[model samples]
Target: MTLFSLVATHADLDLETVGILSSGAADVAGSVDVPAVTLATCNRLEIYAEASSDDPAALEASREELIDAVAETSGVDRDTIASTFRTLVEDDAVSHLFQVGAGLDSAVIGEREIAGQVRKSLADAQNAGTVSGHLTRLFETATRTAKDVGARTALGSRGRSIVSVSLDIAGDMRGDGAAFYRDACVVLIGTGAYAGTSLAQLQERGVRDIAVFSGSGRAEQFVAERGAAARALKMEELSEAFSAADVIIGCSGGNRQITAQEIRTLAGIGPEGREKDLTVIDLALSHDFTPEVADLPGVELITLESVKMAAPAETEDSLEQAREVVDAAVQEYLTERQQRSADDAIVALRRHTQSVLDAEMEKVRKQHGCTAAAEEVEFAVRRIVRKLLHTPTVRARELAAEGRTEDYVQALQDIFGLEVEPRERPEREQPAKRRRAEEFTPAELAQMAAHLQKVPDGGFCPHHRPGEFAVERLEVAQRLTQAQAS
Candidate 1:
């Protein structure tokens, strides 16, 4: 099978385009004849597919199909995409995926959400009915390796995601994050995944009494799930809520932006509307708040562009640890794959030899014509067969495990005069039935649930406080805006 890949990461593509690419990939599965899986996160859009053949024309056609699908969905030029989008084939494709799972390729460098994203990609393929055993094995290996790296190494010892990073930045925004969250009346906008995440973050920070405004009018149900007694607001209460809110976090789905006019109207409402030192965080890809709203008096807006993970200072050591883990995992995978490939040949050779011995033993028994003589003759032949086959069998298995299967197969044919038919592994109809990953104890579920949400670190991160780059950038933007105002 010929594996193919294409990647667009945070360095090049925006999150919106990445979302488009993911949707395209989901739809593209219907069109491609080959088995394929797509993994799209805020940081990267990647696809892995195994074609039936490695013929150049076939590969080229497959490549073009992927490029065209992404182009149509994201409206990017094929050539432009080809320029920056990395392509990997066969083993290289496998290596890239492993690194991604290991978090070596993460934007935040060893972000924890990637493992879940990898799992999600596999699940999505399974639900789409586009992936089979090979992809499943690869994904399982990658995820297992990722968990190993996280647990064993310093690569992701703290375990952080984009949510944590964003929260860390927010924490550093107004002194300590924990302090800000504890005292602040947080107004959470949106009723989707991010909203849930934000609430979890607040809960983690000991923040309750959160005002929920559901963009989809499902606030009551969302609040009910948490057993929260806080009153859920309708769409109209958003402005009134914002007036008293110390922080308004927007993680709503879609393109419903909060206009500058809305803030102005709130300000015009007199005492309650005159909010001081308001912090607005728009975590949505399609920003929930307009930029002009940030220019409002007593307002501060932090979007994805401004907020980023506070990368650990001693990251060189962490990166080295991560690389080592990935390298070891890859080597292990390669060895296992080789051993599996060898199993069929080894089994075939043994079966072919056994059949010949059985025929010879039958002849010897017929010639002996006596029970005692036939038994002795049978024992002798078995010993001869064992002695004759021992060295070749042992060497063949060794060669197989070492990725020298062709030589092993050839040696069997040349030395043993046995031509073994290649064994075919049929596609498994279903994965071995097992508990869903989501099945866990209440405490375990809470921890896992927190992983999916916007979990803010408690100010102990390496990038905890603002550095020169972030501070300078903030100052420059403020200066430019001030000049424009004057």
Candidate 2:
């Protein structure tokens, strides 16, 4: 199956529209016919799906299906959903996911949180039984690629995020930089992932007095579970909490917009009674605080928009390093996927050869009555067959990686009279074994990390050329064939 994705991110739509799209993202998978994974973050809502074919018309139909499902579920109009969501097909889809997992696509570039979110989206799809083998590999590779980028580049090492950027802006607004965090009485309105991240970041900056409020009444549970030495604010306690808080962070992922008037009324502050400076950070896609809150006396607001505008530009060296890693990863993933396309042809050719060997062995057994000589002949014949098949096997992979698997299959059909119908091996019986993340030793990883810094464009070292490597391998195989023939 060909992979495609319908992506509606903050880049395409306003954060509010993204939030609206994300609200019902969980249900979109149920409406689609194909194996699907829905990645619904605060600023992005994407459905990565496996379509039946890579044909443009077929992919367009698949896109329409996904769009209809999202429109129905999200209550976004069909036209808007169709126009807003970017449809990425096959290679483009794969590349986009890798970029996203590497945090290159984040609002706060190189933010560490998105990698985990991408992984979680895969897990969520698996849990819901909506994931396929293709999609599973896609996401797993994306995660692994992200880890590689994180390890090899300076991009993701700092664990940057909306929370961190917001805090930085808040600190600057407070005129004390990060030192202001230590003395700030922070009130966090959210118990979700962003809130948890925000809480961790706040504590990391030496903030001590913190309170969490969940609109869904999970504040107490969230506080207890997180092991934070902070209080959970009850609904009635919000007024007191807001009034006392020096910094208010909103990440509750709720729809109720906490308006300027609401904050004023809740905090018991009036037009003439504005007492202390307050920093309001609305990190939620569905903003918890209204935009007008920035108008309040002594109030400084940091919304996602503000963060996007104020977010520091990444150093070119770090960004270039990350992109190199991602590009290499994308090419590798595509080559592997392309090679897998030849599996059925390879299996067919091998089975055909095995049948020929079996028939010849049957004749030998009939003639020799299972003698030692018969066994010897069988062994020699099998060895010869393996040697003869080796080049075909290698060529199959090479052809497939070059997107010429159809030619390989046609050659087999013409030469061996083998008609191979493509078939998927059962998941349990799948042959390709991916190298696990843990397989690399620390020393090897360090070498790779160092190589990334030194390697120029195309992500290959001076010692290796991909084209030359493939040519050398094929030449070696040809020499082996010549030796066997001689």
lDDT of all predictions, in order shown?
0.73, 0.84
TM-score for each model: 0.71, 0.79
Q: Which parts of model 2 have CA positions greater than 4 angstroms off?
A: 352-391, 401-403, 409-486
RMSD to the hidden true structure, all candidates: 20.1, 15.1
lDDT of 1 by residue, 346-415 (tens): 7877788789988987887787775888888778888988897787677777997768976776676787
| Clashing residue pairs for model 2 | none
Worst 10 residues of 2 by lDDT: 469-478
- Candidate 1 residues lying further than 4 Å off, grouped into runs, are 12-20, 23-25, 190-193, 226-232, 253-256, 262-273, 290-293, 309-314, 347-396, 406-486
Error of 2 at 192 (Å): 0.9
